[model samples]
Target: MTPHMNTRRAAALAAVAAMVVVGVQTGTANARPAAPDDGSSASPRTSSPAFSSASARTAAIKSAQTDASSTAGSLGLGGKEKLIARDVIKDAKGTVHTRYERTYAGLPVIGGDLVTHIASNGKLKGVTKATDARISVPSTTAKIKTAAAARKVIWAGSGKPVLAFESVKTGVQKDGTPSRRHIITDATTGKTLHSYEAVETAGVGNSQYSGKVDLSTTASGSGFELTDGDRGGHKTYDLNQGESGTGDLVTDDDNTWGDGTGNDRQTAAVDAHYGAAKTWDFYKTALGRDGIAGDGKAAYSRVHYGDAYVNAFWDDSCFCMTYGDGADNKSALTGLDVAGHEMSHGLTASTANLDYVGESGGLNEATSDIFGTAVEFFADNATDVGDYLIGEKIDINGDGSPLRYMDQPSKDGGSADYWDSSVGDLDVHYSSGVANHFFYLLAEGSGAKTINGVDYDSPTSDGSTVTGIGRDKAIQIWYKALSEYMTSSTDYAAARTATEKAATDLYGADSAELKAVDAAWSGVNVK
Candidate 1:
């Protein structure tokens, strides 16, 4: 819940008997991964009529790119502007939604990404633009030098576009995470145009898995390393209570990983490694995604992040997830849901790249919660049954209460159960309650219900009876919207449209699934 940026240089760990220590901070590292080919890619669930194979998905993207190249003018693009395809998704009905990044006069337009929605009949439905501002600059050259700009950068906000200088700042945040602050400033007047910290922080899960867990590790020189060669080479490391740099990789002699207790550092590593693998499997089997970036590479994890740190975060700079010991220094924050939640942040970053503020920020958080819950359910471990509660296993509040409740978020005293004009003004964590509530309602409907021994009593804003559409269907709809219709600046209203469109694409327009989606949103006052 705390926000601070930590500076991280590209650092490596040296292998030791039981650990690898982080040594030396050198080389430059970007705050985030380079723009992925499609930001994210996933085949539709088998039930949906979408393309099921990667080759087919790539072919669809190529076709969409060809169409975008030929129809740029019709899409209201300037003569000098070129559209680069980011992702292309097709619905069960053959409706295509293509996301594109824009470059004007060969310069990247910071907020100029868009999604073009086309119906199965080849009719243009609409286009969602990150910024509605017109893109036109007198010059692409910067009048001010990069050094003179200090800390500002970017082009095209709400008004006309302008050339800007990119200023970079790298250092460690107070919380020990890496920080890469990028500033975009106006080239002509030297005024600040836009700025954002590449590092995002938050707090998660594991010292809570059931008895005897299985971990996938690789053989080292004479021992086994906590590296998952089967799933994109994900490695688990121990920070040794240090706050900075890549810590030592956890190594074992006989390949047996962890005890159920945290006395052994590899115990937390077991939970983290297992959680990462389950989350990976959830995305691959349930959503057809390869990894966090939808690419075949894995992001590593760090345990014992700081002394009693009590938080876990996904840092884009390191392309990894890190966890802290709880307030007691014994409770590892690495729960199953926590791992899914943190990793989902990387998924959001890779795809929509939603600005982590206001309504979009709320959606971003909700996206993680939704998928995190899905991952838990997918894992379906008897020790950790899936539920709509976030942070239930971690015991973050010291009491047995969860961090947030989806069925009725107000129980948290801070989260909003329904949408309102002022919801956007609230912290993103609380605003996320709106979407979380909607998701719960859509998945389980209103009124009292019990699943996996967890009871939920969700209410409706309009007092209308809402029927459940099942979590599988609900998750599919949300995933479709996020990867296809939603953009960086999409808010509650836009989210409604995106999900409705997604439902229409997956199920028929008049199908019960779409109706449930509408009712659920209305239940949350998103309408």
Candidate 2:
């Protein structure tokens, strides 16, 4: 078949797994939704699992937090609310938006300041009146003495806290991006932050942030502390600018850049760039693995795909990654989690090579869900804090509900909480729900727990028996099985055998690790 015909047929077969094909315009506004197809896996996976079986469905699993209840969401969020704040900036057709968010009431709501400027040459001609000229945070708010201190709020705060508008530097570069460098010093404390808007809105070839230089509290007053600027340049914005109380102060080097011109591929590159680095860092530091395949090779990513390719993905053929700019927002399929998910597929491919067809498919699907969640927790982006929710940024359903729920995968129609013989016949994404739920059960256990104010009470079909092994250990065992034991065509029964062996390798055959793995899988009604 032709490439297009192959894609159609593959997508159809992938429907056995709910793979996301993202072939439309997916940007800030006017982007298309994931076209109607098989409900598929709870989300996309790197590739299919080895073999699917009714036996894998019998294998069991384990399972978090709200806007105000991030790490632990069991409490009433301590009054912390959910904020779905978004900023829309349109230069006639294209928009430059910066998202700021916070929680209010119980449900996640949207609120924040996005300054749409009518400038000529990096000089601010005007903003949409919402630009606060004063720092919106309180003086009593803890002053950031270190990047980590500031990062706490960055991951959860609405946006930057602009103390005051210092000066808008202007000039002209031969290119048409932007001819400006924004340098500002907080009047209250005299900390400095600089912003550079590229002159070419179409797409800057490839500039990166070097390092984060602390320009705050220095006697020189203009001294900078670069963090890591070897490949890319960097920018910052204070987070206390617009919020009910204290927020983050930060800036972007080229936040308002990257038009969907043919050259917009750089967008995906940046996504992959940051994503692969962070994922590598997290695995190396947290899990002690080298790369996706347990080797220290650079995983790749592809961005600015076809016209408005609405989805981001990872394929076995190309060891790298890929992303798409939504028709409406450039941040559509290219969110951090999407990048991580695509990359996780590579990890799965090199490790398990699970078939994308049946219950093994669900195991394959959940494999991505589990690691993608871990990746978000790893990067810890200030604005997009890690949560167990999938596709929380990309509003594929637009119902405000994220695409998939780890604690409960069935939140989106067609997902199963427990595996059965018929699961493989369902869409992979949907069918995979059973395994995703099993993974959650293994990690977090079964119960109606509240995370970030979102209430999730997982139920068991065969409630007569169940146990919780916890997420961290579960991840270790799964990764070990995938990397050291599994092959491309291993079936569901083999998954149970490999995982059981993994638990034993780490925790001794008679230890709790093996027992827990067995119990967790059993809790999910797998065996």
lDDT of 1 at 74: 84
Among the numbered candidates, top TM-score falls to 1
Q: Give lDDT tens digits, candidate 2, residues 281-386.
A: 6666555554665433454444444454455555544354545555543443655566667667767765556655555556666677778777876676665566
Provide the clash count, candidate 1.
Answer: 24
Q: How accurate locally is residue 358 in candidate 2, as Cα lDDT from 0 to 100?
A: 57
TM-score of 1: 0.65
TM-score per candidate, chains pooled: 0.65, 0.53
Where model 1 places Cα greater than 4 Å from the true spot, the runs are: 1-207
Which candidate number maximizes lDDT?
1
- Span of 10 residues, lowest total lDDT, candidate 2: 210-219
Look at candidate 1 and tell me the lDDT of residue 332.
82
RMSD to true structure for each model, in Å = 16.5, 22.2
Model 2: residues with Cα > 4 Å off, grouped in runs: 1-272, 327-331, 464-467
